[model samples]
Target: MKKLISLALALFMVLSMIPASAEAAYTQAPMLDGMDLPPVAERMPVEPMVEDADYLQIGTYGGELRRAADGGNWYNGKPIEEGLFRFTTEGVAEPNVAKDFDVNEDATVYTIYLREGMKWSDGVPFTAEDCVWFYNAVCLNKIDSKGIRNCHKDANGNPAVVEKVDDYTFTVTFGTPKYDFIEALTVDLKWHFAPKHIFEEMVQCIIDGKNDEALALGKAICGMEFADVGALGKETLYYFWNYPGIPTLNPYVLSTEEGKNNVKGQYYEYVRNPYYWKVDKAGQQLPYIDKIVGVTVSNVDQKLMLLLDGTTDFETVGMESIPTILESQTQINIYEWAGADWGATQIHFNLNVEDEHLKELFNNADFRQAMSICVDREELAGLLTDGWLGGGQAAPAPGQLGYSEAWATKWTEYDVAKAKALFEGCGLVMGADGFYDFADGTDLVLNIVSVADSGAADTYKVLEPYYRAAGIKCTFKDSDRSNIDNDLLANAVQVMLAPVTNIGDISIVLKPNSMVPGYATNVAWYGTMDETTATGDLLKLIELKKQLDVTASTEERTAIALQMLKLHEANQWTLAYVEAAPAYHAVNARIQNFLENGVWSDIYRDMGIAHCQCWFIAE
Candidate 1:
């Protein structure tokens, strides 16, 4: 018994000395103790998938693809002379020719690394020096450059500082700490990098009095005018290099011959770039598809017909096509998804000219509230788009960074009597001409302008009767796309239907500088608010945005966002409308990994078209 007790005590002592025999240690001992172990894989709480994880994996190979767009000049889309970046279907920004990147502590400075061997279609080597030269010549000078315009200026509007560390290393210094610094490196077509060697030689020749030689060189380098060599100093060169002016950077180069003539009802081809940097997961060269064809069609109707017949692989659809697409659902595959296209439609009012008569009629807060109340957004949505789109507020959508839905339910109801009473309380007297009169008995004529293509004309037609019953003479004017600028700039119309793009970033859409006044959108005919006050407020909000990380709590950010929303809403620039018909797309069954964020409207640079290296074919 004594021996057994001793044995048990010895075993207990041995076990205690073995350090508790844990399944695994949560932490390792210090280096001085010479104990280290690999960390166990932590099991994270499973998160619900926002979208389907398993997607169609369309293999990259031979397939003829067709796409459509409204008539516009290639120059209209060109920011630089060459393609530097291109959008992906997934909408995540990826490196084009750039192999990788390194960012500094405050994120103000960035070091970009390029692929070892890259060449332009013209056979010129694309190096980091080209990037540096381009920035120095174009972006800084803002001379028709294609570079984005964030770090180039301080909040006070000073030139952003930049330096080139080495041939392969470039550094950018911002006047302020901008978390979105990496976005600045994106390529714009107008600010596309020209062969520095070629351009410099031309400049040198011109400086040496060889005008004829310089002119020839200019045409050869990138078709630029070199008449004024004296004015083409280093500063001006830099400005032209960094201008944010183009839509995308990708492996495909724009064909100049096809771009010139109004090439309608034809296909524009984009071939794979042999020098493209990205590789597939299987180590195959990117842009697996041999070519991309952009086909020009008369309208969405024709495009939809072609899509259904399998004559075309892809085309952007309008609201009118949604019903047909749905009705013909089984025969045709539809990938109708929500995404950012233009922006939400808005009712814009001119706020600069203070007409007491107009003010007395519209300035009454209740009258504005009543105007908002009478419009049944859901009903209007059904009528305009057949209910494919709905639920966005006059304020931006909720998930947007600076968006506020606080006033979404504030006045979104159909109450015609309440609207009339609100107008009556404001002392707007109904006149014999079926219109309301001010205190001085002046007739209220509100002219509303709308783009010819958008369904605004039809929308105004529906509102005309309702507004007339409320003693308002609302005149509707439809203008072609070309005449829209003249109409808005001249303030030729009082009320206009316009889109407020980037509603998520209200500052871009709502500021006085916004195309529209009183609204965050540019379609507002009124000029932007006092630049000093609005800009100061914007700067504060921007700073607040920077301080808050992506992982910040929604409640904490909501307060600041609400304050910004209130500023824009109080100005009454944009009478926000619920989404009518959000754009939709259809994809083939064989096209795999087709994913989209809520804002994918038109094809943009971030979507993974170039990266996916896949082709869509009829199953």
Candidate 2:
């Protein structure tokens, strides 16, 4: 399993000499011209990441990029996330923060090389110690260690041993060979390094049992003080944006404080980092845009209005909004990115419902089959998304790892007679109210729920008649998204309809929450598992997920994944509709160098790898 990525080899071979004057080497944003800052040559890494690739255009520096992120959580932290490595548009992993890395034989040990002379946004030198501190001190702290991040653990559930080899080098050794370690690093492990200078003393204070000192340090730096040192470290470092004083390596740093930003208006702002490490082809510091301005939007209508009125330069829109956006004749460039989704909307029944009658019915395979066949998938899709989604069955999309045609079409056909027969087989009888009643003659009414603002109610409204024709009564209920999650965890939801998007190629293994039980995504079987009570298929899925985690061989991992999918096909744990619709995001026509035809995936971290640093707003 020995492998090496030598992306920085060519970079080191032909190093460009820095000009005598800072102005000659690289240009800075006009906003920073008079600020007390180091010269560009001194601030940047000795071998800075050069953006001379043909795919990106050299952009001019200026203007604020107005983006709409609900509640100022910009792109779910994508814009500010700079990981150890990043995936290219071609889906290949490449070095980013770490210049290069090497995996030893059997893939148990990884040696990472950091770029020299790299500095945090606050001008403190970033070194291997920072990486080690993040892994050992913060992540594995004795006070409140939450254990290693799921992705960072190896197949055997063993955490890596992070050690600093030198100022610019570190090694991570796992107990077993982790073949897909690179993907794990690239996908989920953002913030591979932290600013040790800022947080180390506070952590030390906490570790030394000086609670008061730790609190004072945290409050003095970031205006954050938590009784628990672990929680304090986690919040300040993991969610660095909320704390203005936390240094970062990202292109932009949060410029607004908590009280400074309007609470009612819900505004947040970011300014370009003067010490950012990347440079463009023309020797200009990257992040062509000088600042990023974001606002919290109450609804999609507000988002669409911002797009139309030019208040926001970029925003992600749903496929259902395409018709409305097209009719508006707005000049915003709607980028139709290829979606990596198994289904747009899916249904899950609570297998562990507290009510015995509902639980027994939901667990009946025949009842579920009847439920699936009764819905006219195509009609529902047309009514809901204007036919933009093309309807679906309960299966993986064409390019998904374990996709099969038979599975794709299984139990998807609309056959009222077959459904009625299946219902009869389940001992359900037609009632006076034109709906089915349980075996004991009790009337059945499924309370369907979904995320409140997700437009799922409209989908459920269209689906009501289809279910009614099948002799099933259902009422669509709406609640806050968080409340819906709480309901799922509490086993309060009888049926749930929601969007399922983690269908990207690598997601089969990396993100198996929807397919595997115990997680919130598969809340139907959330608390129904134990040694004796676990179903054979459920046990098989658990085993397969474990195998997927540690199996380093891609071929072996795919084989295991297919086995799990086969079990899902036989069991029908969830039903699907409208799979693999194109994902849309609107950008101001003036913004340049944004990637086109990108694959929208959670594994790819959405827009994190889209080279936003190269995007410029044209005059």
Residue pairs whose backbone atoms clash in candidate 2: 155-550
Taking the tens digit of each residue's C-alpha lDDT, what string does model 1 give over 443-489? 77887777776767777876566667677777887887546655554
Model 2 residue 210 CA deviation (Å) reads 8.4
lDDT of each: 0.47, 0.74
Q: How far is candidate 2 from the true structure (C-alpha RMSD, Å)?
A: 4.0
Clashes of 2: 1
For all predicted structures, in order, the TM-scores are 0.67, 0.86
Per-candidate total of colliding backbone pairs: 69, 1
Model 2 per-residue lDDT tens digits across residues 488-535:
667688877773233334456656656676432456434344324456
